[model samples]
Target: QLGRCRSVKEFEKLNRIGEGTYGIVYRARDTLTDETVALKKVRMDNEKDGMPISSLREITLLLQLRHPNIVELKEVVVGNHLESIFLVMGYCEQDLASLLENMQTPFSEAQVKCIILQVLKGLQYLHENYVIHRDLKVSNLLMTDKGCVKIADFGLARTYGMPPKPMTPKVVTLWYRAPELLLGMTTQTTSIDMWAMGCILAELQPHKPLLPGTSEIHQIDLIVQLLGTPNENIWPGFSKLPLVSQYTLRKQPY
Candidate 1:
């Protein structure tokens, strides 16, 4: 299967669409099938190693994922040299971040519900398969012209088994990060993604980010201000989290 991978020359790059932390994506056309696709060229400039671990993880996960709500990885293609590689993914017309930035009006209640439902469905599938999408945010959610929503960007995703292994607490974007993550909980679960989902659902209504904090300290402060400080009564063992003693939380009973 590795030897049969197609060459990047088979596709015609229409234009550059976007760039992610791991790669640069292009809107391209398959010359043979005349089908439009998203070509993501893996960034290997800084890597002395064969392939980046993030890209390898993404390729491994995407190849096994077969849900409509998840972005599809059609195939892996290559460039002139052995080091040059590209991922052929299903093309999306727009991402929520861009749409939110450019829209003149906010999404209607019904529309917001529809988008959230799709995302929830996708998250359900991921969780069922024991995959945790560590980085779930508006920018990672893509939409097709037909209004189909796809969860994209899997660089930080990981598959968890029983007892869930401890992971880095710094996986998610600060604005959408869950309180547990901010408090330095190493054992993560689907709750982190759900927390981000809540942020996305809230943002769609006002067409703005719910907690747009500039820094981690400010992010935690914003969350505390909105929902009040977490206590043992509400959040059992909240005081025992790894980083709980790092900051002095205000006493607010909201």
Candidate 2:
């Protein structure tokens, strides 16, 4: 069980890191520990409603996950105002998305490999525990000053059974979505993350998004363009997908 929620007054806020789907994160100094930490202010505006489901899911999952490559959720803290809650997490210098945008120079091949390797390791642990990070993107991957990469954000993550249950295909972002997901496959697996990883790896090389499609249909078109049109020979049961009929797929070959 979670310990008594500490007051946010114990920490000194430095600057805002960034806003996530569920809350706004800030860099802070933990007075008691004298250590830097990320304080994510949980967005709970509705007083009538206790806590948001997304925040609850993230807190529950993060509390259970323990891995070097995964961001550590130190504890839950609160502010003086009602509904002002915060999540104390391990501090990281920068996220991969920010680095990609602001860096003067692009990452070297070895550097990219190092980052991706750590991400894969983190992802490996998650998969081993039957957890799926439904939303895997560059912004969610953070790096410390020591070059250590940690996977953050678990709002869309959920553990799966031996035979996975049906998941919403709308979970992942359009650009990094897997082909199967684009074809309206509600069932998901670790392979969906691997597909995003492939996109991330390619993006690292080019220093830009690999598949920045405007919409879902456009995203599929781009994927087909890069990898060629999929067929039964390439992807078994591709023709039977629910959304396949919506597209006039080109006869492009790999």
Candidate 3:
């Protein structure tokens, strides 16, 4: 079990911090200890009724994870007026995405290494626990006051191997996504996360996303253009996917 945290009513909601796909985050302070925390306002009504599956998965997994590299999911609360669900999470000053965007110069080699290493450490833990961070965009990587990486937002995250043959091929965010996922490859592995790690590392060099593909087809075009097309010899059974022929052939040999 993880360490203990106070109840929901203990914190005072400060202001809306940011907004994302699943929810909105707010800055809050613990009325008891005066410590700050981030509160995530998740939309539950959109998913029919009751708690959304995404929030459910996040709560179940985060309650079990006791790691410094991962964000602390403190509590789950229901809004008083609207019944919207909110997740009480550890406070982070900023995210890697905003930092990268606001940077005047590219991250130094050592800085990039440090950032990627922390991310790897977090991913290593999650992957070891059979968890896949389906959405690992830069915005999801939060930085603490001491410059540590906390893997947050398990809304799209899931624990695989629950089923031997996982049927899901479409996961993960676009820019930092792995080639295996982008190509609609079967099987999920730590390698998929590593591919994203490579892209994250590459992004730090220029302060720009390495593969900023807008959509799956354009993403594939960028991939084939940058890394060249994957053939059956390289990525065996490449032609078997339902979406393999979604785009016109890029002339793999070109």
Q: What's the distance in Å from true for residue 7, model 3?
A: 7.0
lDDT of 3 at 183: 62
| Structure candidate 1, residue pairs in collision | none
Please count the clashing residue pairs in each candidate, in the order shown.
0, 0, 0
* Model 2 error, position 213 (Å): 0.5
Quote model 3's TM-score: 0.89
TM-score for each candidate, following the candidate numbering: 0.98, 0.95, 0.89
lDDT of 3 at 29: 87
In model 2, the worst 10-residue window by lDDT is 43-52
**After superposing candidate 3, which stretches have Cα over 4 Å from the reference?**
1-9, 185-187, 252-254
Enumerate residue pairs that collide in model 2: none
Give per-residue CA lDDT, model 1, range 137-229, as digits (tens).
999999999999999999899999889899999888888999999999999888999999999888998888899999988999999999998
Task: Report the Cα lDDT for residue 90, model 3.
Answer: 87
